[model samples]
Target: MFTKVMVANRGEIAIRVFRTLREMGIRSVAVYSDTDRDALFVAHADEAYSLGPGLAAETYLDVGKLIAIAREAGVEAVHPGYGFLAENAGFARALAEAGIVWIGPPPDAIDAMGSKVRSRALMDAAGVPIVPGVTEPVADVDAAREVAERIGYPVAVKASSGGGGKGFRVALTPEALPDAFEGAIREGERFFADGTVYLERYLPEPRHVEIQIVADDHGACVWLGERDCSVQRRHQKLVEETPSPVVSDDLRRRMGEASVRAATAVGYRSAGTIEYLVSGEEFFFLEMNTRIQVEHTVTEMVTGLDLVREQIRIAAGEPLSVAQDEVRPRGHAFECRINAEDAEQRFLPSPALITAYREPAGPGVRVDSGVRAGSQIPEIYDPMVAKLVVWDVDRESARRRMLRALDEYVIEGPATLIPFHRWLLRQEEFIAGGALHAELNRMADAPTPLPPADGAAPAQAAPGDEAPEPAPQAERHFTAEVNGRRFAVALRYDPPAGGGGAGAPVPAPKKRAKRSAGGAAGAGGATNEVVTPMQGTVLRTLVEVGQQVEAGAVICIVEAMKMENEVAAHQGGTVKELRVADGQGVAVGEVLAIVE
Candidate 1:
């Protein structure tokens, strides 16, 4: 085994890798940006280095800087956990040329599966069923339209080099093609730096399932069952479970065998997943994640395998530990992604200070978290704070265990998906093994209970109830958070001069910053102030100064936590003063435009 390994990522996944490295008696190194300097993963690593402060392009995704740091740390292998440059073939090649071990599949395998257009052709040639779509990149909007016409209505214009629901757009009719094509291209260029896109026949309703497969350098490969990731929102999985309530034994065997074939076709090694779109009895290839998946925990729960340890061992030239027939999964497992987001508000990202935090504890409940009570959930990365996983004897029992774990989870600051998961697990459609994501749009508009306030009850007392006066010379404490950073403050009392007595009031300190019961000083309203609900960077300002607009018109788009949110006008009027420009950073309740 390698003596030292560097985790080239952050958040919960980084911590997940560190734990496995420690178990294998290997030292773990961490690279972090200034925003993540105080993050939990940084503190967990045996060694840490700084990547300065900037966007992902300048920090986590900076290949050159990362390689330099790894060389400086004298690490043997690098583990690109899930995001950032996990699938970047160039990065993998760069690391290999620098003589450092890359704990992932080969660069050629990554390249083969990096582009959807290329992968579709490869899958077709390898006898893996692929969706009916154009194998070549659609030239332009007209080209996409032509392909759509051939494929019939309800075509999907997806970015050739995209995954994780980033560069996907669906058009139900010819009239929607222009906007869909343009949006997909823009997001593709923005995220992947690839403007190429392809057309596919969109499936209205299909269950999302993916098979977990691991390969070794010694020509050994095994499939570890399948995970049903049908519970989703905006095409991103919110909940995942293994031993799918809907998958039959024969179907599992077929998918598992096909997964092994997919991995073998690419000469793949280490851990990778083959995602499929299953419609009743048939399943088509969706994409191949050439790295460890976010839901790998659920697979580990039921299979009794340490996937990261296996990945590390495989990268170290170790052979497979278990054979294909010995890869039988048992019981049931579920993973709920606990994110700092408001589910009722269209699942908007809410980056804020986690004033209080607690993980549920039980026999089978496991929490992989990267935040503490004073942790700051910044708006620069994914909004996932942690993952809550549970296992039981069966699917229904696992669902109930997940519910109990969720109820016991205490994350008090920004609104989270705990309540939403609680609601979803009990839905009739969900209980019947149906993919209930089609109802998310309608559920987003429903009224919901707000998250708890710093684990403190409401300050309002009974009609005649009153607060007891503070005793003189007693010390007190007050705390606050500014710009998603935590702080702890102590306010002590010392009686002034001589005539101090019991119940004497202490002079209040001068106010430092202006705040309100609702939020910041100048928040959005029915009239003017077009304010942002969260802190983020302005991706675009649609309305120029002096432009006339109507109420609820989208004035600009803000990018927070890698997700785009449209900031709409509070009321109808002329855009008197545009306060923000594209690429400018703004804070919560910060004004973006002034209208009259």
Candidate 2:
């Protein structure tokens, strides 16, 4: 076994790796960006190194810097934990050339599965079932349109080298193909540095299922059952559970065997997952993740296997510790990605200081987090704050335990998806194991509004008469900046009779300046402008000055927290001014372009 291993990641996954390394008597090393200097993972690791600024491209994704750090720290092996450079074959090769063991699958395996087009071909040749679509990369929108026409509508325009819901767009009709194709290519190049893309048949209501496989250099391979990751939003998984409610014993056996065969065909080793989209009893290959997944905890809870430990052992050239026949999964488990996002506002990223933090405890519950009180959720990386995993003897018990754990989990200073998870647990369809793709859209569009606060009630007034004031109360408290100086203020209001409050009401706080719905006024009138809906980088500007556009036309694309959002014009007009250019940083409500 290796004596020292450096985790090339951050947040919950880094802490997760550290815990397993400590148990195995291995000295864990952690690398952090400037913004993460005070992060919990840095404090917990046996050794830590600086990785420059918090920008991912300059810090975590810088392969050369990571290799140099590993050499300096005398790490025997490096574990690329699931993001950033985890799937980069070049980084793995670089680590190997530096005489350090890479605690992941071989670079050759990552290379083989790095591109979706090539992986589709490889899987087909290996006799693995795959979706019906073009296996070759399509160049430009015209070529994409032809391919989509051939494959039929509702096709997925996907980046050849994309994962985790990035670089993918769906074209449900012939008219939508152009935008989807261009958007896919631009996002592919921006996120993965690869512009190659392909077409695939979109599965309308398939359950997302995957088989976890671990292999060793000595040719011993074992398939660790399966996980159902169907609970998703915008193609990103929000909830994952082991032993899918829809997957039968016979189907599980078949899928496990197929996964083993697929791994063996690619000469794969270490821990990996082969994802599939299953509808009814039929299943098709989605793609392979070349590292430990975020939801691996549920598998560990049910199977009692440490996937990271297995990965390290495999990288050390050890044979499989457990054989296929010996592997037995015993209970149902659930995992919810506790992200710092507002579930009511389309799951927008909510980065702020964590004033208070608490994790749930007791039997069948585990929390993997890297933040505590005073931890700031930076906007540079993923919004996932922690992972909540729970286990029980059966699915029902596991569901109930998850609900209880969610209720007990407390966090402040940022909006989280806690309410959404709680609501999902109580849904009848979710409990019945129904696929949630369509239902999720409906929920996001019109979520149930939260109830009023305790003791709060609507005020009733008599017709035509001035409402009588009952009492004065402070309704809201916040801080504001005046002329570059900050001051705390409270919003006060007088309530009618029967309201519970005492004393005279103080004046309300001054209101902040509000930007006009339109942009800067032109000579004719106020120019209608398209503004960014969130803080992010401008990925592209789709409109130019003097260009005539219609209402709802997309004018630009803004990427926030790694998710791309289209900024569209509000009304039909001619483009008057372009305020921002590509690659520029923008704040929420900042005007991007003006249309007159």
Candidate 3:
């Protein structure tokens, strides 16, 4: 076993890897950006070093800087936690060239499965079941149109080097194909620096299911089982569960075998997941995630396997200890990604300083979190604050345990998906395990009003009359300046009191609704709040107390990623007060506005 390993990432996953390393009596090193200087993982590591600024391009994604840190720390191996440079094949090769063990799959395996277009062809040659789609990159819009016509409308345009839903778009008709193709190309170019894209048959309402596979250098491999990740927004998984209620034992075995074949074809080692889309009994290949997944907690809860430790063992030239039959799943397990987002608005990011934080604790309840009470959720990275996972003898028991855990999980200074999760657990579709990828979309499209909170006080319309149809209490908005031009941003927020249960109509700019106040009352219905749209510094606030203004007026400017963004008013009202000033640091949804 290696004496020390440097975590080539930050946040919760880094801390998670550190915990496993500590348990194994291995020293751990943490790398951080300037913004994450005071991060919990940094404090927990036996050694630490600065990567660069908060900018991803200069920090986590900087492979050269990361290798330098590894060498300076004198670590025997480096573990690239999920995200950042985790799946970068070139980085893994560089690590090997530097004579440091890369605690992941071999570089060639990563390369083979790195590109979706290539991987699909490879999987087809290996006789693995794959989604029926184009085999080559689209040459032009003409080729895409031809493929779309043959495949029928509602086709998916995906980037050749895309994952995590970036550089992906869906076109429902020929007329929308041009826009979708262009959007996909633009995102691919910007994010992946590879404008190559391909077409796939779009499964509008398919369930997102995937299998976890772990292998060793000695050619031993096992499928830990499968997970259903149907609950998602914007193609990103929000909730996951093990032993999918929809997947039969026969189908699970078949999928597990297929996953093994896919890995073996590439000589894959370490931990990876083979994702698929399921519709009824038919399953189609989606893509392969070549790293430990954010949803791995649910699998670990059910299988009693430490995937990280297994990854280390595999890297240390040890054979996998468990066999296919020995890999038995105990019970149903569920994981809800506790992101710093509000479910009431639009699942907008809600990064802020957690004034108070408390994770649920008990048997069968596990929380893999990186933040504490004083931790600030930096906007430079993903908004996922933690993952709340629970296990039970059955799905119902697991659902109940998840609800209990969510209720017990306390967070202050930012709105979260806790309320929405609580409401979802009580819904008929979720309870019956009938949720699909389109479920959230259906709820979002519903034309109903959100119900009031259980103990929320009624709103006083205009500060005098008895609450005339309680409007939603103060919600937050975030802003990110893309260029020197201060573009008005529509920050993400959650739904109202009912969460996504009652199916409220998507909010419109001109629509006025009454919201009941949840806590203390304020003058003219103002509570003195201002929130950042993107992770950046507060450049200036243009509003003052008793300032009369119309709706859509600029109130402040936030400098994020070197761009200036203007914060605007949601309603035509007077500014009651300003919570922050010029040059003050802020995060997403820090409560910047209090208008009457």
Candidate 4:
């Protein structure tokens, strides 16, 4: 085993890798950006290094900075945990060139499966079942339309180098092809830095299943089984369970064997997942994730395997600890991704300080979290705060246990998807083992009722009686420095009581008037400003000052959390002023342009 290793990632995944390394008697080194200075993961590591600012490009995604940190930390290997540069062939090759072990598949394997178009071609050559589509990127709208016509209607325009549902769009008819093609290309270029896109047949309602495959450089490989991630929204998985409700023993064998064959074809090693789209008895290849998956917990819960440990051992030139025949999966497991977003608000990101936090425990419940009570959820990264995983004797029991655990999991700062998960668990369709894509969308469209207060009492008087008295307040004080000046701040929380008297008055601090992002009133004191819907970077501006545009015209593109969103005009207008330019950082509601 290696003496020391550095984790080139952050959040729960970083802490997860640290735990396994500590158990294996290996010292773990962690790197963090400015926003994560006080994060739980930074505190959990044996040693930590500062990676500069919170912006990903300046810190987490800086390959040279990471390499220098690894060298300074004197680590033998680096683990690129599932995101950032996890599957980057260049990063893997660079690590190898620096005489450091890369705890993932070889660069060749990553490159082979990195591009969907290229991977489709490779899979077809290896005799793996693949979706019907062109195995090459379509250059423009005309080419995309030509390919879509051949593939038939309801085709998918997907980024050739994208995954996690970021650069994917569907064109259900010929009229939607132009927009779909343009959107996919923009997303591809923004997220993966590759403008290549391809067309494939889109299955309206297919179960999303994936096989967990672990391989050693010594040629020994085994499939852990399959996970059903059909419960999704916007093409991203929300819930995942192992021993798919629909897959049978015979089918599992076939899929597992095919997954092994696929891995072998790519010359793959270490932990990876081969995703598939299953419709009835027929299954087609989706794509291959050349690193550990977020849903790997469900497989570990059922198979009783330490996948991270296996990855480390494999990278150390170790052989497989168990043979194919010995691999067995027991019982059922489920993982719910708890993200900081409002389900009722179209799943918009909610970044706020976590005022209260608690994790469920007992029996088979496991929570892999990255935040605490005082942790600030930064807008610079993914909104996933933790993953709630549960296991039981079977699928039904696991489902029930998950519900109980979710009720006990407390989070009290930003709005979260807990209520949505609760509602989903009670749905008849989900309980009956149905892929609830359309159902989830319908539920999201409806208003989600707020969860009841943690603890409350019923009224003790009749409707005509006076209202109950307010509770006494608790005051907490803190000291802080701002701009070389020290100030004391006090917070008061009111609890229920039986008193009606007014409370003591506290001196109020001086307040400063703030201007809205729309800026001062425009011409005729009637402002028509275009604002950013979310916090992100301005990738490019589509219009110049005084440019006339119609309603819904694209004015600019903003990149946030690795996804690009086009900012459009709400009404026909001329661009009076462009307050933002390319490469500018913007906050939610910040004005991008003025229209008049």
| lDDT at 333, model 4 | 97
lDDT score, candidate 1: 0.82
Supply candidate 4's per-residue lDDT for 186: 77
Q: In model 2, which regions exceed 4 Å deviation? A: 443-531, 545-551, 569-577, 593-596
Superposed Cα deviation of residue 58, candidate 1 (Å):
1.6
In model 2, residue pairs whose N, Cα or C atoms come closer than 3 Å (at least 3 residues apart or on different chains), thus clashing, are none
**Residue lDDT tens for model 2, 85-139:** 9999999999989999999999999998888999999999988899999889997
Position 3, candidate 3: lDDT: 98
Clash count list over all predictions: 0, 0, 28, 0
Cα TM-score per model? 0.86, 0.85, 0.80, 0.83
lDDT per residue (tens digit) for residues 223-277 in model 4: 9999999998777789999989998788788888999999999999999999999
Query: Which one wins by TM-score: 3 or 4?
Result: 4
lDDT of 4: 0.81
Q: What is the C-alpha lDDT of each candidate?
A: 0.82, 0.81, 0.77, 0.81
Candidate 3, residues 1-596: lDDT per residue as tens digits?
89999999888899999999999999999988999998888998999999867588899899889889899889999999998889999999999999899999988888888899999999989878777788789978999999999988789999999888777899998999997898788668866788999999898778889999999978688999999998887677888999898998888888899999999999999999999988887788888989999999989998899999999989999888789889878989999887765554435455567766778999899988888888887655777888899999999999999988976777665556676677677766787896644446533322122323332222324632233322223333345677666664433344443221111112222233322222111122233343444456676677788898664556776654333445666545677868888778875457777887
Q: After superposition, how far is residue 337 of candidate 3 from its true place, in Å?
A: 0.4
- Using lDDT as the yardstick, the better of models 3 and 4 is 4
The model with the greater lDDT, 1 or 2, is 1
| Prediction 3 TM-score vs. true | 0.80
